[model samples]
Target: MTMAGTLYLIPNTLGPADAGAADPLRALIPDEVQAITAGLDCFIAENAKTTRAFLKLVALQHPLAKPLQEIQINELNVNTPEAMLPQLLQPLLEGRNAGLISEAGVPAVADPGANLVRLAHAQGIQVRPLVGPSSLLLAVMASGLNGQSFAFNGYLPVDAAQRGKQIKMLEERSRKEKQTQIFIETPYRNAALLETLANTCQPGTLICIATDLSLASESIVTRTAAVWKKQLAAGKAPDLHKRPTVFLFLGQ
Candidate 1:
């Protein structure tokens, strides 16, 4: 019987590469993650290009024993066929450790990597999640909202009316159940989403906007709808345009 290799869940940095910066991997991503990542030559990633870029950064810290070209990266994305998922674990079945990486943050959380992870478990492969940054957890932690219970809604409806209705429903649920409602939007549409939130939610509803987390330009602010509206009126609100952000809401 062949021993199955462990499947490591590796976390990638949220921002672009900065070779000159101090601790470019950020504070939360520990040395252990880098060490573990260095050992794995096969990776299943959301995007092969970005994953290779991340590997290069890791190589900066720990030189790769094998040539960079030798490293195998299998791409996984939303449109990837479910039938092809098992192929991603072939390395593990062959007694070679494999890494699951996302474009940013932890894999399998908001990423399609979850499908592969689920298959790994069903195949009895060892699934190990390394310590790393998660935008969802970070936002909830800093939001000062109900961390005890929170829901990640991914992305709300794109239509204006539908989006407003969805926002109102989420707000109502948050208030009634005392749960934190978390969601995200395309970076470009962030400002519009904030506008919808301000219009749809009650004045006392608490909204947390966490953007560029773990980066030099990181910003995390929690304020009521009324307060945020006041800031908007004064042109003091942080611009979320083209910035990766996590939005959390809790009704007061």
Candidate 2:
């Protein structure tokens, strides 16, 4: 019987394709991780095009085991059907090592690759996760909040009133549990979310907005809601529009 191949959870660069770096991977990805990524010829990715782009950068440091055109890539995203997971896993079951990649950061955290990772474990396949940048963890580390006990709340409501209620609810939970609440927003709505966070949360709540994590333009700021409100009032709010960010808060 053939040995089941291991499932490698590979991490993509945290920045965008054109993040103004000569080589984004060189700065963020460890040499060992890049070498492992270079050896894989089969991958399951959130976006095949973006995965190929990431692979191209990996090739800059270590030549790929197979040429880009010859490598096999399968797509797995939010819309991928549950029934399609087995088909995607077949090559691995048949002894072909495969990599799982997210559009950015590590796969299976906020990415849709979670289900596939679960299925891989159910199949008893060996799973190995490589070292990489995770924006959620980075934010928690920089927030000066409760990193020992923190929770990632993903994306919040988009509606203003509803979003406000949700922010209050999260703040309350943080206050009671002494936990840090971490979340994200659509790039275009980042400023709006910051505005709402400042307006809705209590005066003493600590709000940390970590933007462009691991990139040259990265910024991580932790301030109380009152201070944020003051900034908003004075029109001194940082420009967050159309930038990738992670928002976290811990209430007193």
Candidate 3:
């Protein structure tokens, strides 16, 4: 019987591609990661185009054994059923190492690749996660909140009322349990989410806004909800619309 190959979890940069000397985001990705990626020929990714683009970037540091076109790429998305995951890992069963790459940041953290990781563990396959940038942990590190006990609440409800209710619950939990609450929103709706957060959370609640992490336009700030509201009222707050951001809430 062929021994099952290792499953590698690969990470990608957080922002838009910029191939220049000043591309700070590129520096966040480790050299070892690119080397490992160059050796792998099979991959399961969130988006094929983005994955291919990243592979090309990896090629700059280490030459790939096969042509980009010849490499096997399996697309995985939020809608992909659990049953189809086994097919993605078929290469590993054949004694060929396969990689799981996310659209950005670490794979399976807030991405849709968790199912495959779970399956790998059940099958007793070796799962290795390489070092890389993670927006969630970065936000917590900069927030000055209770990093010792924090919970990542992916995306709250989109509806105004429901979202507000969810925010209250998160704040209550943070206050009572002394846990930091982390969440995110679609880039386009970042401004709206900020507005809702300022209005819904209590005046003493601490809110951290972390945007464009590891990029040239990176910004991280923590303030009370009251202070944030005052900034918005005075037009002093930075624009967050259409930018990738992570929000953290800590109640007093």
RMSD of 1: 1.3
Query: On residues 124-146, what C-alpha lDDT tens digit does candidate 1 reach at each position?
Result: 99999998889899899999999
Taking the tens digit of each residue's C-alpha lDDT, what string does model 2 give over 1-252?
889898999989887655445665776788999999899999999999999988988887799999999999999999999999999999999999999999999999999999999999999899999999998988888889998999988889878778888898999999999999999999999988888989888999999999999877999999999999999999999988888999999999
Report the C-alpha displacement of residue 103, candidate 1, in angstroms: 0.2
TM-score computed on alpha carbons, candidate 1 = 0.96
- Prediction RMSDs, each to the true structure: 1.3, 1.5, 1.5
Clashing pairs in 2: none
- Kindly list the per-residue Cα lDDT of model 3 for residues 84-203, writing each as its tens digit: 988888889889998899999999999999989999898878999998899999999998999899999999998888898999999999999999999999999988888888998999
Q: After superposing candidate 2 on the true structure, give the runs of residues whose Cα lies further than 4 Å from its correct spot.
A: 17-24
Candidate 1, residue 103: lDDT: 94
Worst 10 residues of 3 by lDDT: 17-26
Off by over 4 Å in 3: 22-26
lDDT score, candidate 1: 0.90
Score every model by TM-score: 0.96, 0.96, 0.96
Residue 40, model 3: Cα distance from true site in angstroms: 0.6
